[model samples]
Target: IDGGLLSPEAVAADPCPHGMTRELCGLLCGDDDPAVTVDPDRPVGFALALDCQLAGDSPELLDDAQLLDVVEGAERMERWASALRTRMLAVFADRHPPGSSAPPPGADSGAAAPVGRWLPDQVALTLRVSLEEARCMLAGAVRFAHVLPATLAEWEAGRIDERKADAIAHATSVLTDEVAREVEARVLPGAAAAPRRLLQDRLRRTVARVDPQGAARRHERAKADRRMSISRSDDGMASLWLSAAAEQTEASWRSVDRLARSLG
Candidate 1:
């Protein structure tokens, strides 16, 4: 009935028999008695924690080999969960399927009906997420699962993380299939090593290079579609939101900053 013992995190943070705190939160808990008893701050204890899927006690415990494996393993777990979510999204997408030959209730018999009509609503309800999040994730899942094999492979191997994969996905979305492969070939190698912001800039640049016409069209569209809105915050505040070309937005932001500083 101990509340702290309720999760693996609690277990690893428990004290070791040696009186030094166990490095892992869950590796030393639950009365199972570790087969190898050592301070989690030590290599054996850290390895044991990682092997058992608990949080590591400390980074110092990992050797170069263990460090590599543990970091890669963390990414592998993220990749696995993303793949699982994609499959689950597929289950929802296929509940009625998008391209059924049959007509819907209000349609003529020969017309092709849109199926899976309730997918976003059902997903939101089941996952307890907002409808916007559900729809975006569903779209991302479909894109990642079906179209981006190279990025997916890199992510699965832990060579790249979800954010980088997402960056690749967003950058390539406007590209034709042939052009996207070219972009992937150029971008995927550096994704894991590059900081995400730097990778995003590179990816955008590459996408422009690989598909100049498409990039130009999207840029023009973005410029033309600049939008602003007012939204109320939960804490009795209001936010003025605006989205436009980067240069224009930055200029506007600088003006606001200048005005605010002048009064101060």
Candidate 2:
């Protein structure tokens, strides 16, 4: 049975101290009749009213042209949105700039608890995402805004997607700001034509030449995080994953291949 929004029973049972008006309730419920119940899964309420209203205006019959138009629009706009997200995050960072004194003046240095310490938690609650997921997203936004202008511009122009932009940012992370920009400028021109691994390799070489000291430091830091794990796949097959230096990983693979061949 469909629930009524403005029915007397609903008004009487409403949580508000003062009964909700039928007019206000009608506006809140937004299918065909404002007085009807809202199904959140297939929402036509105040939240999705604009989009729902536009979709309703279109003919029920959707042809190939309409479908293609929607897909194309989504692809283009997604890139634009990625660029805009960087800007939005820039504003957010300014408001709560990292290293900006979390505490006010005159407070004891040890006693000052940083403001916005719960930023990731706040973002998680607002976006209905896990804290780890929120931190990852925030990290990506910061990278795109501050680290990868060339990649962000490419995405804005619809030449690349968010994944490739992030890949560029992460691959060049160890370089100094000047070197990272130089590497990005050199790599982006051929990005659309090149495989992702090729770009990563090029970035690695660029880092090794441009800032060898920084690269070595990063390598040492990465070595601290290296490990291996084994797990069973859904089909009961065993799988192994290793995090290690590229050179050592390749040597290990080669040794394993030779051992298997000798056994055969």
Candidate that would win on TM-score = 1
Lowest summed-lDDT stretch of 10 residues in model 2? 36-45
lDDT per residue as tens, model 2, 1-264: 137555666656764333224335445565464422222233212323332333334524345554444444445556667666665755565566665545433456675555456566656776698989877777777766777767877787656677677778887876667778888888889886677788778777776877788878888999999999998878779999989998989998999999999998
Give each model a TM-score: 0.60, 0.59
RMSD in Å for all candidates: 10.0, 10.5
Residue 89 displacement in candidate 1 (angstroms): 5.5
Measured by lDDT, the strongest candidate is 1
Candidates' C-alpha lDDT: 0.68, 0.65
List clashing residue pairs in candidate 2: none
Error of 2 at 82 (Å): 2.7
